[model samples]
Target: MSTAVHTMNATALKGRARDLGRRVTVLMLLPSTLWFLLLLVTPLLIILVFSFGERSAVGGYAGGLTLANYLNLGSRAAAFSNTLLLAPMGTLVCLLAAYPLAYFLAVKVQRSRSLLLTLVIVPFWTSFLIRTYAWIFILSGKGLPAMLASLGLENVRLINTPSAVLIGIVYGYLPLMVFPIYVSLEKLDKRLLEASQDLGASAFEGFRRITLPLSAPGVITGVMLVFILLMGEFLIPAILGGGKVFFVGNALVDLFLQSRNWPFGSAVAMALVAIMLVVIGLYLKLVARHGGRPGEGAL
Candidate 1:
């Protein structure tokens, strides 16, 4: 009877400990949860509400619901077109440039790997705005254009063009694309490659069958990261394109700050967020179909 009582007491103690642990976990998460509610969720809710409302005669949101703001999205069709086209193009460029460098770093470089990685990251330590501003001078008539002109290529205008924006995009986002793929390649098993070779597989065959599939997760991650950021990019296009190549981000800025069309801006912002969510969802489903987990690296 005494032993039974002792066992019951121990069980009660264990239950209390579990309760305490649950309370501690709730406490730990409380601040972040409150912050999210106070900042992100609240702001998004406000934006969503404002999106359906009317704009004041002078500016800002006016009460009462209407779809006029959404309908007016057609006015910014050019911005949408530019963003959709250039963002993907920029992502592709970054991928093309980044993959080879990442591969070399991961698969070929035997010494000073850390140093090389540091070199890739060192540029990030400087301000992005500063770096982009420098590109303005670098692409000016006196810069690369002049050097090329002296080499017999005439009238090569790079600054304030789509090409200049692409150059800036690739330079800025290459590191993001590089690191994920590098991690995937670095973690790959060499034994698999050796075994494939032993089975009479050529290098290309081995890469196509084994390496590519395994590295897909990282590739997708890099593409997603670069694509998402490019979708919202404004600075490079603003500085390099000289307002000629406008994106959705540029449109948003113009609406909010320049035009002071708060309701219309909110509608645009909400639409942008919705589009992003849809894209993310579709990409996730595609990755699921391929059985690829982002950042998992090569097995």
Candidate 2:
């Protein structure tokens, strides 16, 4: 009887505590909940309704529903192709460049890490648009080509080419690429690396086996962040590619702004959202399958 009484009292105490905790949590969450509902949720609901409606001849939404918009999805296949291709390429390039820089920053410049990091972020203080514009002068005929021409090179057009676009993508997204990998490598244990070397492993081998795997979470985050944003990229391609290299963002832009086809625009927007979902799903699957940590999947 005494044991049962104690058990009951313990259970009741836990229940009361949980109730109090719930009240506290609700009080804490109320502001954020209301903010999201007002800003995000409501806007999303409006967009969903707009997607189903027709394009007004003048340029906006009209009250009607039809599958014609979705049927036109195939029209932007080239744009989709460019996005799927360039996004991966851009992300891979960023990763290739960023990993070494991150490794150097994390392992080499211990005393100057904060200063170097500040330098990396200094560019971000300015608008990304302004920075991309700086590249224009650099790649223009009078900047790079001019120097090359003085050295007896033939005609060179770097300002409006695919290579220029790639360079722009690399420059714009570098800081984003740097920070995550830096954080991961900075937090990594140095002793494991020494242990590998002590076990007769080369510096390269130790890094390949240990440093890379340990920083896999950061790698995944940096790649995903770059890739997802790349998929929706417009300004870089437009400014650099000279309208030759179209992307989904360009297609959406043309549909909405130039053609005044809101229905088709909505369909394209929906398709973009769908593609993002698929990419995110595949990314999660890959992370889970590759023995990455739980926190990595969340990233």
Candidate 3:
């Protein structure tokens, strides 16, 4: 009877302990939950509500139930098209440029790796706006064009052009692309490559079969990061293209700030959100097919 009583007491104590733990967890999560609701969820809800309304005669949202805002998305089709095209193109370019550099930092450099890595990110120490502004001078007629003219390639117009926007995109977002891939490659198991070599696989073959597959998660992450930001990009195009190139972000700015067309801006913002969700869904499916998770290796 004594032994049974002791076991029962211990079990009851354990149940109480679990209940206490659950309460503690809930308490810890309360602030963050409230913060998320207050900042992110609330604003998104407001935007969704406003998206269904109409623009007032003077400019802001006029509450009503209508689909006219969405129906009028055709007016800004050019901005959507430009954003869609450049975002992916810029991501691909950044990927192509970042991979080899990441590989070098991860695989080749040993003693000075930290220094080189710091050098890669050194540009981030300065203000982003300042850095972007510097490009204006560099690509202007008195900058690269002047140097090129000296070399017999005169009349090279880079500023206020799509090429200038692409260059700015690559320069600005390269670090975001590089760090993810570098981390992925850095953590890779080098012994796998040696084993493949011992098993009579050539370097390229080993890379194709082993290294590429393992590093896929990083590539996907980098692509997604760059692509998503590029989709909403405004400053680079605005500064580099000199307002000649328009993106969805630029359009949003114009609507909300300049035009004060709050309802239409809200509708556009909601559409952009939807498109991002679809793109992210497709990316997730691709990751699933390859049997890898973001920020984790296939192995």
Give the TM-score (vs. native) of candidate 1: 0.89
lDDT of 2 by residue, 1-299 (tens): 99999999999999999999999999999999999999988876776666778988798888687877777778889888888888888889999999999999999987888899999999999988888888889999889999999999969889877788888899999889989999999998898878778888898887777888888888888988998898889988888777888889988899889988777787888888888889889988977788565233221
Q: How many clashes in each candidate? A: 0, 0, 0
List per-prediction Cα lDDT, in the order shown: 0.89, 0.85, 0.91
Query: Which 10-residue span in candidate 3 carries the lowest summed lDDT?
Result: 290-299
List ranges where model 3 is wrong by over 4 Å. 1-4, 291-299
What are the runs in model 2 whose C-alpha is more than 4 Å off? 1-3, 291-299
Q: In angstroms, how far off is 98's CA in candidate 2?
A: 0.4
| Leading candidate by TM-score | 3
lDDT of 3 by residue, 1-299 (tens): 99999999999999999999999999999999999999999999999999999889999988999999999999999889888888889999999999999999999999999999999999999998999999999999999999999999979999998899999999999999999999888987899889889989899977877777777778888999999999999999999989898999999999999999999999999999999999889878977886554324322
Q: Mark the regions of model 1 whose C-alpha exceeds 4 Å error after superposition.
A: 1-18, 291-299
RMSD of 1: 2.8
Give lDDT for model 3: 0.91
Ranking by lDDT: 3, 1, 2
Question: By the lDDT metric, which is better: model 2 or model 3?
Answer: 3
RMSD of each: 2.8, 3.3, 2.3
Better of 1 and 2 by TM-score: 2
